[model samples]
Target chain A: MTAWKEIDQHVKVWMNYARKLILAQIKTDVQVSTKSGPNDLVTNVDKEIEEYYVKQIKLFFPNSLILGEEGHKDSGMLKHQGYFWVIDPIDGTMNFVKEQENFASMIAIYYNGKPLLGYIYDVMKDKLFWGGPACQAVYCNNEKLNSPANLSLKDGLFGASCPMVLRNYRGINEVISKSSGARIVGSAGIEFINVMSGKLCAYLSFLRPWDYLPGKILAETLGLIVKTIDGEPVNVLSSTDVLVATDNAQSEIFKIINNY
Target chain B: MTAWKEIDQHVKVWMNYARKLILAQIKTDVQVSTKSGPNDLVTNVDKEIEEYYVKQIKLFFPNSLILGEEGHKDSGMLKHQGYFWVIDPIDGTMNFVKEQENFASMIAIYYNGKPLLGYIYDVMKDKLFWGGPACQAVYCNNEKLNSPANLSLKDGLFGASCPMVLRNYRGINEVISKSSGARIVGSAGIEFINVMSGKLCAYLSFLRPWDYLPGKILAETLGLIVKTIDGEPVNVLSSTDVLVATDNAQSEIFKIINNY
Candidate 1:
């Protein structure tokens, strides 16, 4: 228990530190460029923030394994004991570089393949969603999470990847046309906040491990569905097309996405 | 000039009033229900606010036509000599009902088929994007508008409806996959904020007049392309697929969508 508390405290400190550094860079003229194409933007802030977290991780917890989005440590090993830290120093890099609002910093800690901690920080909003399976508390900043009002896709909003909608993403169009309507917030971190806050009925994305790990921890803690679209158990180490929804909402989404 | 200034003042005053009332309704346990489905939602606040805006519009400008999301007015005839007020009293209704954070109240005024005024109030953020073709001054709260850095889709981020990319609405997927990245914030008003702030290269959605009307006014004022998917003028009284982008970005998007 003390170790858990220690880990949480240590992580909290690092997150605040990273947040300060990142926002400072964003407020300045940081050099920006493209990765895959015109829309996929990356900035020096993403790299600098990640390196800051990694340096702290190595110094305080040398035994812990690190996996990050910037391709810093490609040791290519997910299986670890003691502790493993999966980090996206800037989870929504495009949003961070572009919107400067919706992006997040995500970090998840696992012990012996058991989820222990997750944190998704929205810098612009100044909100932090933090928790784990072992901890009974999932918090937004200092406030405890109130379980989202029970709602289904037909009754609530869906957070979806825009590209998926056009490809007939297995009834996604139908989902939007049928639902109150669809909303597309650009960042996974913001989407996770919406889900945990019970704003969106569900959020599904072509997501990577670091992109979702922290959100998965928070969502699961708040009693939301965190799984692959096919209803398979999520393998946190891989990038999976995942859905995070309320229990009742999951069934409705499943019926829709499957038919699409 | 007197008429424009008076109406602009009226817009700002009523926008603030609507913002407060909407926020108050959010804090209250207002009634909420599904619209088309769970993804689509409506609260009593959305309805009341629209009614309130219409009342204000008809009171001040008795002959002005009104278009709203809650089916408030008839925009069938937007003739010359008077004004047409396009209002989405509470944009991002789902967010207002569910998360209560990401919504906005948008208003746009046009006269003789030309944009006269535009305002998108980020109630939660307390920031307002306001200007018009006649005003030629875009302000967020009190800050004056400056020409944004000219960036292409490849050099910037984009906002699209989540489901639009999957089924190939104008080859959005190929365009998105090749660009910096995509973000889908569920609200057109909010997405319009991204474009006006110069964060997004573009935002494309199948939107009605109320949905894209204010957005078109602001996007145009900010030197962004807000047009129909095909090469035609956006009919402010009709629901259509609208694209708001930078010049070069729009050309790239046009090429891609046309190809698809």
Candidate 2:
């Protein structure tokens, strides 16, 4: 595997650049429109930011396959390649357009479909979480990161979508309710960061590929599980109920989700 | 009545000072302890910010009664006081502590228990929603804000306690389903801003006095309904299931809530 230290440096450059563009492009008189429903939103800022990140990827690493929200790129599928970057230029766009905070710019680099680097920047706060390369995965703002404990769901908090709490989703409610508790931050990148830092034992949300990839790379590198809620291995090219967690958390969570 | 221009100056001066002290006190490693439950968190930042605002209030207007979160306040219930201030120095403390974002600073000032001035500041975005004292009140940042349409419950979105979306919570689910959709921003001040701005037709949440006062002032100023789900007027010093909405939205919401 390539040294994550070198890759993190390169990814940070692109992440920070997109962060600047995103902030600059955010309109006070934002053009707000519903996506799936009213809860889900896509502002011009979201689409523009995603496009900006895709542009940067093609310029810096022309051969790198790009996967992004807003259909900014079409990597088609994960392939053994020199480099592939997954980007969610503005994760939590509703929060960005409405509240204007708690959103992030996320990107991940994969070398031959294995983790090489990951970065999720809290644009407003100027803090970034990044790492990959499982043997010595890291997570932080240009600081060292320790791999989280292999905690079970019962031992820690979980971050997830609201449907899971209402038992509207499959085995999620049972699996999640049995945990210490749940925290829904409404962004995959933030939830993914929570799992990597041990703030959360697991995060289960119906997320698109761009939303899941950066976090998935970061989670897997931190020795955490990144799988579907049904315990199926994730299909990287499509959206899924992605569950990212520590190994012990995954096993314990699987028990609760097994009914599905 | 004092002009909004005059009131804005005073409210903003004090808020900026409070925000500065708050900014200095809060950081990633601040001491955090649980409150109410594991899900609820309180940091030293909360206490310090409220105290600073209290001190500023004493210096600026000695006669104004003051009510503040963090238990540092000493003022009676909303009465026919000549001048008074209600402050939630740091709203969304859970988000502030865990996510370190999405929290806000809020204040509602009144003369004789009538809405005189209101403010809800998204600290990260540095945008303040402020206005009051009128046959009709309005909100804005440095510029003027045009009120969004008084859409019905079936037409606009709602923000509320996630619990309201499920288990009926007084038929909130049906009321919400009638709406285009729902969003849970996890901050009363922010949620209330959405309601006042008409981005959401209604907001219902379990709230303490501190959470209600500022939003209550703003919602009422916008020709909207502000009350408990049971149709009781919110007591300025009580815990309640507070609801804020336009008149039409309120009617629709209450009817459904009554049925459930």
Candidate 3:
């Protein structure tokens, strides 16, 4: 068995370093570029942060396979026999470029295809929600977080993607209308933190691997459900329509999605 | 004209006191009640804060007229001959009860039927966005804020009430689709802050006097437009469909709303 405590300490140190670098760039001119379209944005800072994590992981765990959002996918490196790491360098790149707030840095670790550890760092707020299967508990900064209540669709607020709601994709409008309200924070990691902290009951969006990986691990550790909208297991290797919610909310949401 | 600097100092002191009272109640259980529906919430803290402000206002400016969200409307007091204070003790009460963040305490002061000063206190973050016609500039905490860019509707994000979007009220869905995206922060004060800070280009909602008064004062001072959706003036004494936005965004949004 790995020394999980020692690994946690090391990861926290690197994450704090990453936080410093992120804070230093806020309000300064950042070179932003389009990814798929004008709405999809990526920045030089995102690439720099991803490269920093890849270098740190290789230095500390030399044999680890790495997957990053900023084009670091090397299928040949995936032996699937040892440790693996997924990094999102900067989640909510649009919010990062626009508001300079509400974005996060995320990392998830796996061992032999099993989830091991995850971290979602809200760099602007100086909060790191981290934990994993090995620890069996999630911590926000220093406080161990309690699992949110298993609220039904009517009992709590919902978060969803704007495009999905505007288009009423897969009946998301029906799902959101039943809740207290809908919130669109524009950051999947921040939305996940809302679910984990009980601020939101569920977050539904079509997300890429690096966008949902760390949030999924951290959320699942707190007794929440993280799965595809179709009630299928998340592939972890491909993009999917994702739903992260408390148990009761997931059951309620599943009924709506299935009916559609 | 009215010892504006001295009054500003006094208001800041009272606002800080109110902030302390609010922070103390967070994370602790408080009685919650419905105002119009389950989605429209009011808490004991809301009532307490409103009463606290009323008491302070009476003690300091004994002759001032007060209009508050939690039933402090006395039409007889509104002769438009002296000082009038409008207050929304907790602008986003649902958020305050559910998330304990994103809510704001708002106050607007009018002298002889003209707006004199306004304050929007983001209680949790300790950010007070305050200014007035007398001051000629708004301030976030201590620094004077710059006016946000006059971006067109297609250039920035938009915020709106959930029901409005779900029902496509006034063609908001079409307007939102034309923007970069939609964001729903659930607080008019926070949404106004976003527009003033250039994070969101526009915010649309049906708002009461206390809900939009302070934000309107600050936003107008920053050169943003605050008007009824029908191109009429917003009455300071009643509820109306209000739209607050940058100049360019307002022109674009007006076309859509008028067409609908």
| Top candidate when judged by DockQ against the true structure | 3
Cα lDDT, all candidates = 0.79, 0.74, 0.89
Least lDDT summed over 10 consecutive residues: which range in candidate 3 chain A?
A: A73-82
Stretches off by above 4 angstroms in model 1 are: A33-42, A72-81, A162-181, A252-260, B1-3, B33-42, B58-65, B71-77, B111-114, B162-167, B170-174
lDDT of 1 by residue, B1-260 (tens): 34677887888888888877876777775787767754566778888888988999889888788877887776445675677778888888767766677778998888876788888888999999888787787889889977566778777677877557545566777777756667667788988888778887788888888888887887788787778877578876878898888888888888887887
Worst 10 residues of 1 chain A by lDDT: A72-81
Clash counts per candidate, in order, are 45, 0, 0
Q: Which pairs clash (backbone N, Cα, C closer than 3 Å) in model 3?
A: none
The better candidate by lDDT, 2 or 3, is 3
Candidate 3 lDDT for residue A7: 72
Instruction: TM-score winner between 2 and 3, please give it.
Output: 3
Candidate DockQ values, in order, are 0.50, 0.16, 0.82
Put down candidate 3 lDDT per residue, A1-260, tens digits, no spaces: 45878778878888888888888887785889998988899998898889998998889888788999999985743458778889998999989987889999999998888888999999999999999898999999999998998888898899989989988989989999999999999999999999998889999999998899999999999999999987789987789899999899999999998898
Residue-level lDDT tens digits of model 2 in B94-205? 6675445567999888787777778899886777887765425655676666665677876676775754544557767667567755566678998887777666788888
Whole-model alpha-carbon lDDT for candidate 2: 0.74
Model 2: residue A194 alpha-carbon error in angstroms? 4.7
Candidate number with greatest TM-score: 3
lDDT of 1 at A186: 64
Greater lDDT among 1 and 2 belongs to 1
